[model samples]
Target: MAGRVVRPRQLAFALSHTESLTRDNFLEGPSNETALALIDSWPDWPNRIMLLSGPEGSGKSHLATIWAEQAGARAISAHSLIDTMVPDTLVTGALVIEDLIPGTFDERALFHLMNMAREDEAYVLITARVAPASFAIPLRDLNSRLRAVPVVTVAAPDDQLFRALIVKLCSDRQMTVDESLVSYLATRIERSVAAARRVVAELDAESLRLRRPVTRALAVEVLRDSA
Candidate 1:
């Protein structure tokens, strides 16, 4: 019998694997210290489960992926888990489940999967924008389970961290960012690591379009037009 190939719905989330993780890729700031320390000292045993919850652009996924690499781990999205028929045990090595809130409703399945990972001594790193307590799980179980797990929250990066991140991202893309432009962006844009990222990405595209270096004027115009 020929099996059918069913295509799944296109998910709104985006995960980039092409990018490499280095110290340059990680921005240092007080906001990220605990998370950084956990990442630096990863594969800390018994139960290798850590939660990364934060708003977009807080570098949760980047840091998670970096930690996975450091521990020779593999990253997977929660949506794929729903679509696939494979057993959890088949997913070897350290595991990163991005957007874990979506899985909280399925208590039995999630609990089973977590237990399986624990039994096998494989690391499980789950990330979500919201904490687990906010999910649609049965109140008592969800509360108890979440409290037992080690939670690491990524705070929105500060201005210094944001500027450093933008500069590093621009450098990685082989683009030069002017000091005035960096200063202007650090103050004028939304106070978020994510906002800095979008602005820098737009600058990259616009730089290609205009065939000119990214400048303070270009940043202001693009950001204003975007707003």
Candidate 2:
């Protein structure tokens, strides 16, 4: 015991992964077919203004990116909306306002942007966790405009899509997971893309620290520890 030499444990570093948001990278399933169709419809949209809604990590941003690429749209955050920026924001004749929340952004700026887009026949794509129609916007005209805009909602992932998402998330982290681990995670975790991303990230970090391969046993440990 006196001669025992203890090796230092490995340090798990947090590295950033750039996820591909291109059209080819998006996974299609029943949950998102309608949303995909809406993007593909493009200029033929029911209205020049459209609202894209979904739960977090439900691929709303991804679909928005695809549409933006096709439409040459400029992307902006809802919080950054300003009355004076409305005209310049739509220079490309298209815009994407991401992560819009009620009461967080300038209601007047949005109202002005909507009117400007309508006047110029520009396309505006708004992404939010919930539909804008459901938001309690104080601006009466803005509320009416948002309610009239066509809404496309992305639902939660199905079984096949869930498994595919787990695989994709793991691959994004450069972790090679087999079916057993995938199946185990699918049943054990919440059925959402965000949940899959979180669990896979945790497992990867844990495996690196422990110097162990990712497997069902490792998954059990990670899941339990997180719980």
Candidate 3:
């Protein structure tokens, strides 16, 4: 029969993939080993109020989500602390304050929140791009408390972690990439998850559009676009 060829639903490509947020999925190496260890050592942490500091896209949010899920925590922002219901949220005993900037935060609200956390024996995990000590804050009480909070840092990914991230990122897109390509990209690209993600996504799309495998030459083109 002379007819137009039709594609079946069974062979449909997934435009998205579920990101499995598990401890195993977190690629751990020397770069972030101490940070991961500290996260795992929660509840036993020296200070109930701790700051997890890391560069952008270094999986801090992922670790925060993991901790929040385990601790039955509530994720809140600096602005949200000013809300009246904040007191109610604090009752959760576990809180993750994401992207807290010292000067931009509500001083009084944070002061009260810390007091309440201590009173209730609650734990606080504050994630930021820099350590608490580096924050520019003039509020004496708030700054004082922030200074005392223990800071755990996740350095930029090492070569091993970077390669692992390439594989994990590809896997997230339901793509099995070549090991040689991974090694090539890992060595050539900066050690950043954001960069890796951009490269992988662009490569996937480019390969699909051309109906070709992910090749070194294609990778070079995509890497330039990623940059």
**TM-score for each model:** 0.81, 0.94, 0.86
User: How do the residues 88-141 of candidate 3 rate in per-residue lDDT, one tens digit apiece?
Assistant: 877779998988876677878888888888989999988888987887787788
| Deviation of model 2 at 223, angstroms | 0.5
Worst-scoring 10-residue span by lDDT in model 2:
1-10
Tell me the spans in candidate 1 whose CA falls farther than 4 Å from its real position: 1-20, 83-91, 102-107, 139-143
Q: Give the lDDT ranking, best first.
A: 2, 3, 1
Show model 3 residue runs off by greater than 4 Å: 1-14
Show model 2 residue runs off by greater than 4 Å. Answer: 1-9
Residues 88-167, candidate 2: write the lDDT tens digits.
99999999999888889999999999999999999999999998767998789989988888889999999999999898
lDDT of 1 at 206: 78
What TM-score would candidate 2 get against the native?
0.94
Clashes of 3: 0
Q: Which of the numbered candidates is closest to the native, going by highest lDDT?
A: 2
Best by TM-score: 2
Query: What does candidate 1's lDDT look like per residue over 1-227, in tens digits?
Result: 99999977443333232344565567779788878878887666434777888888787888887877777666766655642322543366577777876544445555666666667767878888888766666646645676577788889887778888778777766778889999998888887867776787888777776767889999888988899
